[model samples]
Target: KTRPVLDLRPLPKVMADPEQFPKVVTNLLLNANEAIQKKGSLIRVSTSEEGGWAVLSVADDGCGISSAFLERDLFRPFRTTKKQGMGIGLFHSKKIVEAHRGRIEVESEEGKGTVFRVMLPVGDGVREDG
Candidate 1:
């Protein structure tokens, strides 16, 4: 229904839990898709390196989170805006990111869009070039 765009950038491999990383990305992507109610909207995913962190972000031009929810309810277990959402997706995502000593960031404007970023510390992984 909407355009999907990816602008992934190369980064030195960061050590992360094999299973949990995918789960986090999956949840983010799912949310991006679910946020859009318009047929011509967009969902974008990107990756990059910032300072000493590896960043992964999912953004969507769709109905965005309310400030009240963003400030108080997000990442809290069982507090959901969706009728079907269990609300654990974000809650567990936060836990997993923190377990890796990472943090999650949010940027949203109601009626405009939302961007969710997961920032993780650059792990000690051997460079392939070397």
Candidate 2:
């Protein structure tokens, strides 16, 4: 059995709530792990800069999500492919990202793989005015 491995890319410093960031990471990791049914699958985590945002991405070489689900079902509460899942993982992850004025996106092709991207603004604190 091969365990999932993470390949984390470098990232810049961004002002964010520390408490919520781990939740986002954990949710993505869980999703990646669930995609693979066998051992030796890989999960990659990377970060980079995109325009005014700090981009973080998690990729998995496992059973990928369907296009329909990627577009519609991923963020919905209580929607999961797994029989044992509560389905609140991605929902809560999305909420945490948005609360920090960020955006989360996913790319997946059935039988190929999946990639999840989270983008956050770079700043010292949340802007009160906006």
User: What lDDT would candidate 1 get against the real structure?
Assistant: 0.86
Write candidate 1's Cα lDDT for 1-130 as tens digits: 7888999999766878999878889998888888896422899999999977899989999899999999999999999888787999999999998778788999998888999999887767333432
Task: Please give the range of 10 consecutive residues that has the lowest summed lDDT in model 1.
Answer: 121-130
Query: Scored by CA lDDT, what does every candidate get?
Result: 0.86, 0.82
TM-score of 1: 0.91
Clashing pairs in 1: none
Tell me the deviation in Å of residue 115 in model 2.
0.1
Q: Model 2 over residues 17-95: C-alpha lDDT tens digits?
A: 8888899999898888888663228788787877767898988888888888877788999999887989999999999
**C-alpha TM-scores of all predictions:** 0.91, 0.86
Give candidate 2's error at residue 57 in angstroms. 0.7
Poorly placed runs, candidate 1 (over 4 Å): 38-40, 125-130
| lDDT (C-alpha) at residue 93 in model 2 | 94
RMSD of each: 4.4, 2.9
